[model samples]
Target: MDWTTVEKNWAAYTPRVLTRWPGLDEDEVLATDGDLDRFAEYLAIATSQSVQGARDEARGWAEGEEPADAKMDPTRDNERIFDSAKNIPVGEDVYSADADFGDDRIPEPPMDRKAG
Candidate 1:
Protein backbone atom coordinates (compact mmCIF):
# COMPACT_ATOMS: atom_id res chain seq x y z
CA MET A 1 0.00 0.00 0.00
CA ASP A 2 1.08 3.56 -0.68
CA TRP A 3 1.78 6.07 2.06
CA THR A 4 -0.91 8.38 0.69
CA THR A 5 -3.59 5.77 1.41
CA VAL A 6 -2.31 5.30 4.96
CA GLU A 7 -2.30 9.08 5.42
CA LYS A 8 -5.86 9.19 4.15
CA ASN A 9 -6.93 6.56 6.66
CA TRP A 10 -5.16 8.55 9.37
CA ALA A 11 -7.12 11.66 8.45
CA ALA A 12 -10.47 9.91 8.14
CA TYR A 13 -10.63 7.40 11.01
CA THR A 14 -9.04 9.81 13.49
CA PRO A 15 -12.14 11.81 14.30
CA ARG A 16 -14.49 8.83 14.55
CA VAL A 17 -12.69 7.38 17.56
CA LEU A 18 -11.86 10.64 19.28
CA THR A 19 -14.71 10.47 21.82
CA ARG A 20 -14.14 6.83 22.75
CA TRP A 21 -11.84 3.79 22.44
CA PRO A 22 -8.35 5.18 22.43
CA GLY A 23 -7.48 1.71 23.68
CA LEU A 24 -8.71 0.46 27.05
CA ASP A 25 -10.83 2.10 29.75
CA GLU A 26 -8.63 2.14 32.86
CA ASP A 27 -4.95 3.02 33.34
CA GLU A 28 -3.01 5.35 30.98
CA VAL A 29 -5.45 4.87 28.10
CA LEU A 30 -7.77 7.40 29.71
CA ALA A 31 -8.18 10.35 27.40
CA THR A 32 -9.54 9.93 23.89
CA ASP A 33 -8.07 13.24 22.82
CA GLY A 34 -7.71 14.00 19.09
CA ASP A 35 -4.00 14.60 19.46
CA LEU A 36 -3.26 10.87 19.27
CA ASP A 37 -4.32 10.86 15.59
CA ARG A 38 -1.16 12.72 14.71
CA PHE A 39 0.86 9.90 16.20
CA ALA A 40 -1.27 7.40 14.30
CA GLU A 41 -0.66 9.24 11.05
CA TYR A 42 3.06 9.35 11.71
CA LEU A 43 3.14 5.66 12.61
CA ALA A 44 1.08 4.63 9.61
CA ILE A 45 3.34 6.45 7.21
CA ALA A 46 6.46 5.15 8.88
CA THR A 47 5.12 1.60 9.02
CA SER A 48 4.22 1.45 5.32
CA GLN A 49 7.62 2.71 4.24
CA SER A 50 9.37 0.51 6.76
CA VAL A 51 7.54 -2.60 5.66
CA GLN A 52 8.13 -1.96 1.98
CA GLY A 53 11.74 -1.06 2.56
CA ALA A 54 12.28 -4.19 4.61
CA ARG A 55 10.74 -6.33 1.90
CA ASP A 56 12.86 -4.74 -0.83
CA GLU A 57 15.99 -5.05 1.29
CA ALA A 58 15.32 -8.67 2.02
CA ARG A 59 14.75 -9.38 -1.66
CA GLY A 60 18.00 -7.72 -2.55
CA TRP A 61 19.83 -9.62 0.17
CA ALA A 62 18.45 -12.88 -1.16
CA GLU A 63 19.72 -12.02 -4.66
CA GLY A 64 23.30 -11.45 -3.40
CA GLU A 65 22.99 -7.68 -3.90
CA GLU A 66 23.12 -4.89 -1.34
CA PRO A 67 19.80 -3.24 -0.56
CA ALA A 68 19.38 0.07 -2.41
CA ASP A 69 18.39 1.88 0.80
CA ALA A 70 20.66 -0.06 3.15
CA LYS A 71 23.26 2.72 3.32
CA MET A 72 20.84 5.66 3.23
CA ASP A 73 19.33 7.33 6.27
CA PRO A 74 15.67 6.30 6.47
CA THR A 75 14.66 9.50 8.19
CA ARG A 76 16.51 12.47 6.71
CA ASP A 77 15.68 15.00 9.42
CA ASN A 78 16.93 18.23 7.88
CA GLU A 79 15.00 20.42 10.36
CA ARG A 80 15.20 17.97 13.29
CA ILE A 81 11.45 17.50 13.41
CA PHE A 82 11.51 13.93 14.77
CA ASP A 83 14.13 14.85 17.37
CA SER A 84 11.71 17.21 19.16
CA ALA A 85 10.31 14.33 21.23
CA LYS A 86 13.58 14.07 23.15
CA ASN A 87 13.47 17.78 23.98
CA ILE A 88 9.76 17.85 24.81
CA PRO A 89 8.66 17.75 28.44
CA VAL A 90 5.93 15.16 28.91
CA GLY A 91 3.87 13.80 31.85
CA GLU A 92 3.87 17.04 33.79
CA ASP A 93 1.03 16.15 36.18
CA VAL A 94 0.07 12.51 35.63
CA TYR A 95 2.53 11.58 38.38
CA SER A 96 2.12 12.62 42.03
CA ALA A 97 4.78 12.86 44.72
CA ASP A 98 4.69 11.64 48.32
CA ALA A 99 6.51 13.04 51.37
CA ASP A 100 10.29 12.69 51.29
CA PHE A 101 12.23 11.10 54.19
CA GLY A 102 14.72 13.43 55.88
CA ASP A 103 17.79 13.33 58.17
CA ASP A 104 16.02 11.34 60.92
CA ARG A 105 16.06 8.10 58.87
CA ILE A 106 18.69 5.47 59.71
CA PRO A 107 20.98 4.24 56.95
CA GLU A 108 21.01 0.52 56.14
CA PRO A 109 24.47 -1.16 56.42
CA PRO A 110 26.05 -2.91 53.42
CA MET A 111 25.95 -6.72 53.28
CA ASP A 112 28.80 -8.46 55.07
CA ARG A 113 31.37 -9.93 52.67
CA LYS A 114 32.33 -13.59 52.92
CA ALA A 115 35.77 -15.02 52.03
CA GLY A 116 36.06 -16.00 48.41
Candidate 2:
Protein backbone atom coordinates (compact mmCIF):
# COMPACT_ATOMS: atom_id res chain seq x y z
CA MET A 1 0.00 0.00 0.00
CA ASP A 2 2.67 2.49 -1.02
CA TRP A 3 1.46 6.08 -1.41
CA THR A 4 3.29 6.48 -4.71
CA THR A 5 1.50 3.51 -6.20
CA VAL A 6 -1.76 4.89 -4.96
CA GLU A 7 -0.88 8.37 -6.25
CA LYS A 8 0.08 7.12 -9.67
CA ASN A 9 -2.98 4.90 -9.75
CA TRP A 10 -5.02 7.90 -8.65
CA ALA A 11 -3.55 10.05 -11.37
CA ALA A 12 -4.34 7.42 -13.96
CA TYR A 13 -7.74 6.93 -12.42
CA THR A 14 -8.39 10.65 -12.29
CA PRO A 15 -9.35 11.01 -15.92
CA ARG A 16 -11.68 8.05 -15.60
CA VAL A 17 -13.48 9.45 -12.56
CA LEU A 18 -13.66 12.76 -14.34
CA THR A 19 -15.37 11.24 -17.37
CA ARG A 20 -18.68 10.71 -15.57
CA TRP A 21 -18.23 13.81 -13.45
CA PRO A 22 -16.13 16.41 -15.16
CA GLY A 23 -15.73 18.33 -11.92
CA LEU A 24 -14.39 15.48 -9.77
CA ASP A 25 -11.25 16.37 -7.87
CA GLU A 26 -8.16 14.69 -6.40
CA ASP A 27 -9.69 14.85 -2.95
CA GLU A 28 -12.23 12.29 -4.06
CA VAL A 29 -9.47 9.82 -4.77
CA LEU A 30 -7.57 10.55 -1.57
CA ALA A 31 -10.70 10.20 0.52
CA THR A 32 -10.76 6.45 0.02
CA ASP A 33 -7.24 5.56 0.96
CA GLY A 34 -8.04 2.05 2.14
CA ASP A 35 -9.77 1.13 -1.09
CA LEU A 36 -7.28 2.73 -3.46
CA ASP A 37 -6.94 -0.38 -5.54
CA ARG A 38 -10.70 -0.81 -5.91
CA PHE A 39 -11.15 2.88 -6.61
CA ALA A 40 -8.30 2.78 -9.08
CA GLU A 41 -9.94 -0.16 -10.75
CA TYR A 42 -13.19 1.75 -10.85
CA LEU A 43 -11.36 4.65 -12.35
CA ALA A 44 -9.91 2.27 -14.89
CA ILE A 45 -13.39 1.15 -15.81
CA ALA A 46 -15.12 4.55 -15.97
CA THR A 47 -12.41 6.94 -17.15
CA SER A 48 -11.58 6.42 -20.82
CA GLN A 49 -14.15 8.68 -22.44
CA SER A 50 -14.34 10.98 -19.44
CA VAL A 51 -10.57 11.32 -19.26
CA GLN A 52 -10.49 12.33 -22.90
CA GLY A 53 -13.18 14.87 -22.12
CA ALA A 54 -11.10 16.26 -19.28
CA ARG A 55 -8.11 16.42 -21.60
CA ASP A 56 -10.18 18.26 -24.17
CA GLU A 57 -11.33 20.72 -21.54
CA ALA A 58 -7.73 21.26 -20.37
CA ARG A 59 -6.54 21.76 -23.96
CA GLY A 60 -9.42 24.11 -24.69
CA TRP A 61 -8.59 26.14 -21.63
CA ALA A 62 -4.89 26.18 -22.53
CA GLU A 63 -5.63 27.28 -26.07
CA GLY A 64 -8.29 29.77 -24.99
CA GLU A 65 -6.29 31.34 -22.13
CA GLU A 66 -5.44 34.50 -24.05
CA PRO A 67 -8.74 34.95 -25.84
CA ALA A 68 -11.15 36.80 -23.49
CA ASP A 69 -11.06 35.30 -20.00
CA ALA A 70 -7.37 35.99 -19.59
CA LYS A 71 -7.86 39.69 -20.20
CA MET A 72 -5.72 41.70 -17.78
CA ASP A 73 -6.70 44.87 -16.03
CA PRO A 74 -6.97 48.02 -18.11
CA THR A 75 -3.61 49.68 -18.63
CA ARG A 76 -2.47 53.20 -19.35
CA ASP A 77 0.18 53.76 -22.01
CA ASN A 78 1.44 57.24 -21.25
CA GLU A 79 3.91 57.24 -24.15
CA ARG A 80 1.25 56.38 -26.73
CA ILE A 81 -1.19 58.81 -25.17
CA PHE A 82 1.41 61.58 -25.25
CA ASP A 83 2.37 60.66 -28.80
CA SER A 84 -1.22 61.08 -29.96
CA ALA A 85 -1.56 64.29 -28.00
CA LYS A 86 1.50 65.73 -29.70
CA ASN A 87 -0.05 65.07 -33.13
CA ILE A 88 -3.06 67.33 -32.43
CA PRO A 89 -3.12 70.29 -34.75
CA VAL A 90 -1.87 73.27 -32.76
CA GLY A 91 -2.81 76.08 -35.19
CA GLU A 92 -6.37 75.08 -36.00
CA ASP A 93 -9.00 77.39 -34.48
CA VAL A 94 -12.31 75.71 -33.54
CA TYR A 95 -15.28 78.05 -33.01
CA SER A 96 -18.78 77.27 -31.81
CA ALA A 97 -20.34 80.67 -32.58
CA ASP A 98 -21.84 81.31 -36.05
CA ALA A 99 -20.63 84.16 -38.30
CA ASP A 100 -22.89 87.22 -38.80
CA PHE A 101 -23.39 88.01 -42.53
CA GLY A 102 -25.82 90.65 -43.79
CA ASP A 103 -26.06 89.67 -47.49
CA ASP A 104 -27.61 86.37 -48.54
CA ARG A 105 -26.15 85.74 -52.03
CA ILE A 106 -25.67 81.98 -51.98
CA PRO A 107 -28.48 79.97 -53.66
CA GLU A 108 -29.70 77.33 -51.26
CA PRO A 109 -30.27 73.75 -52.48
CA PRO A 110 -33.77 72.28 -51.95
CA MET A 111 -34.02 70.82 -48.47
CA ASP A 112 -36.79 68.28 -49.14
CA ARG A 113 -35.81 64.73 -49.93
CA LYS A 114 -37.11 64.18 -53.46
CA ALA A 115 -38.02 60.68 -54.68
CA GLY A 116 -35.15 59.20 -56.61
Candidate 3:
Protein backbone atom coordinates (compact mmCIF):
# COMPACT_ATOMS: atom_id res chain seq x y z
CA MET A 1 0.00 0.00 0.00
CA ASP A 2 1.76 3.05 -1.29
CA TRP A 3 0.83 6.71 -0.71
CA THR A 4 -0.97 6.74 -4.06
CA THR A 5 -3.15 3.86 -2.99
CA VAL A 6 -3.87 5.51 0.34
CA GLU A 7 -4.68 8.79 -1.45
CA LYS A 8 -7.03 7.05 -3.89
CA ASN A 9 -8.81 5.30 -1.05
CA TRP A 10 -8.83 8.22 1.40
CA ALA A 11 -12.45 7.86 2.46
CA ALA A 12 -11.98 4.20 3.38
CA TYR A 13 -8.66 4.95 5.12
CA THR A 14 -9.79 7.98 7.17
CA PRO A 15 -11.52 5.89 9.82
CA ARG A 16 -8.35 3.81 10.29
CA VAL A 17 -6.17 6.91 10.55
CA LEU A 18 -8.44 8.49 13.17
CA THR A 19 -8.53 5.22 15.12
CA ARG A 20 -4.73 4.88 15.12
CA TRP A 21 -4.16 8.50 16.16
CA PRO A 22 -6.96 9.55 18.45
CA GLY A 23 -5.20 12.80 19.35
CA LEU A 24 -5.72 14.03 15.78
CA ASP A 25 -8.83 16.09 15.02
CA GLU A 26 -10.96 14.78 12.15
CA ASP A 27 -11.23 18.15 10.48
CA GLU A 28 -7.47 18.73 10.62
CA VAL A 29 -6.74 15.30 9.23
CA LEU A 30 -9.34 15.75 6.52
CA ALA A 31 -7.71 19.04 5.63
CA THR A 32 -4.53 17.20 4.70
CA ASP A 33 -6.42 15.74 1.70
CA GLY A 34 -4.39 12.53 1.59
CA ASP A 35 -1.04 14.29 1.43
CA LEU A 36 1.36 12.04 3.35
CA ASP A 37 3.73 14.89 4.24
CA ARG A 38 0.88 17.08 5.50
CA PHE A 39 -0.56 14.20 7.49
CA ALA A 40 2.86 13.46 9.00
CA GLU A 41 3.20 17.12 10.02
CA TYR A 42 -0.20 17.03 11.71
CA LEU A 43 0.67 13.72 13.42
CA ALA A 44 3.96 15.14 14.70
CA ILE A 45 2.21 18.22 16.15
CA ALA A 46 -0.65 16.22 17.65
CA THR A 47 1.46 13.45 19.23
CA SER A 48 4.53 15.53 20.16
CA GLN A 49 6.77 13.26 18.06
CA SER A 50 9.71 14.50 16.05
CA VAL A 51 8.89 15.42 12.44
CA GLN A 52 11.14 12.66 11.07
CA GLY A 53 9.66 10.11 13.45
CA ALA A 54 6.13 11.11 12.47
CA ARG A 55 7.04 10.95 8.78
CA ASP A 56 8.48 7.45 9.20
CA GLU A 57 5.48 6.29 11.18
CA ALA A 58 3.05 7.67 8.63
CA ARG A 59 5.06 6.13 5.77
CA GLY A 60 5.13 2.74 7.48
CA TRP A 61 1.39 2.88 8.05
CA ALA A 62 0.81 3.79 4.40
CA GLU A 63 2.94 0.82 3.37
CA GLY A 64 1.43 -1.58 5.93
CA GLU A 65 -1.07 -4.33 5.23
CA GLU A 66 -4.68 -3.25 5.73
CA PRO A 67 -7.43 -5.79 6.31
CA ALA A 68 -9.43 -6.60 3.15
CA ASP A 69 -12.72 -5.59 4.78
CA ALA A 70 -11.40 -2.14 5.65
CA LYS A 71 -11.22 -1.30 1.94
CA MET A 72 -14.91 -2.11 1.39
CA ASP A 73 -17.31 0.63 0.32
CA PRO A 74 -19.63 1.08 3.29
CA THR A 75 -22.29 3.00 1.34
CA ARG A 76 -22.95 0.17 -1.13
CA ASP A 77 -23.18 -2.61 1.46
CA ASN A 78 -25.61 -3.63 4.18
CA GLU A 79 -24.44 -4.13 7.76
CA ARG A 80 -23.82 -7.79 8.70
CA ILE A 81 -26.26 -8.05 11.61
CA PHE A 82 -25.31 -11.65 12.34
CA ASP A 83 -21.54 -11.14 12.05
CA SER A 84 -21.12 -11.80 15.76
CA ALA A 85 -22.93 -15.15 15.64
CA LYS A 86 -20.88 -18.15 16.83
CA ASN A 87 -19.32 -20.38 14.20
CA ILE A 88 -19.82 -24.16 14.34
CA PRO A 89 -16.70 -26.29 13.92
CA VAL A 90 -16.29 -28.33 10.75
CA GLY A 91 -17.08 -32.10 11.07
CA GLU A 92 -18.58 -31.51 14.52
CA ASP A 93 -22.01 -33.02 15.18
CA VAL A 94 -24.34 -30.14 16.07
CA TYR A 95 -27.25 -32.28 17.19
CA SER A 96 -26.84 -35.21 19.56
CA ALA A 97 -29.65 -37.77 19.86
CA ASP A 98 -28.54 -38.61 23.41
CA ALA A 99 -28.80 -35.01 24.67
CA ASP A 100 -32.02 -34.22 26.56
CA PHE A 101 -32.10 -30.47 25.75
CA GLY A 102 -35.65 -29.06 25.72
CA ASP A 103 -37.20 -27.30 22.72
CA ASP A 104 -36.40 -23.89 24.25
CA ARG A 105 -32.64 -24.62 24.34
CA ILE A 106 -29.98 -25.44 21.78
CA PRO A 107 -28.25 -28.90 21.85
CA GLU A 108 -24.81 -27.39 22.30
CA PRO A 109 -23.09 -27.58 25.67
CA PRO A 110 -23.26 -24.56 28.03
CA MET A 111 -20.70 -21.81 27.23
CA ASP A 112 -19.37 -21.83 30.83
CA ARG A 113 -18.98 -25.62 31.13
CA LYS A 114 -15.82 -26.54 33.09
CA ALA A 115 -13.34 -29.26 32.16
CA GLY A 116 -13.57 -32.54 34.12
TM-score of each candidate? 0.16, 0.20, 0.56
| Per-residue lDDT of candidate 2, residues 1-116 (tens digit) | 24333233444444444554564456765565525444544344446545445444433333321322112213324534655666545553333222323234554556785534
The candidate 1 region of ten consecutive residues with least summed lDDT is 25-34
Backbone clash numbers for all candidates listed: 0, 2, 0
lDDT of 3 by residue, 2-76 (tens): 787787667667888988887789999888988888888889999999989998998888777764555565642
Candidate 2 at 42: error in angstroms?
13
* RMSD of each candidate relative to the true structure: 20.1, 17.5, 8.6
What is the model-wide C-alpha lDDT for candidate 2?
0.43
lDDT of 2 at 79: 37
- Candidate 3 has an lDDT of 0.73
- The C-alpha stretches of model 3 lying farther than 4 A from their native spots are 67-116
* Candidate 3 C-alpha error for residue 6, in Å: 0.6
User: Of the candidates shown, which would achieve the greatest TM-score relative to the real structure?
Assistant: 3
Q: What ordering of candidates by lDDT runs from best to worst? A: 3, 2, 1
lDDT of 1 by residue, 7-114 (tens): 333333333233333342332222323234434443335345454453443233234322233313344354245564465455533233312323435545567954
Give residue 54's error in model 3 in angstroms. Answer: 0.5
Question: Which window of ten consecutive residues has the lowest lDDT sum in model 3?
Answer: 76-85
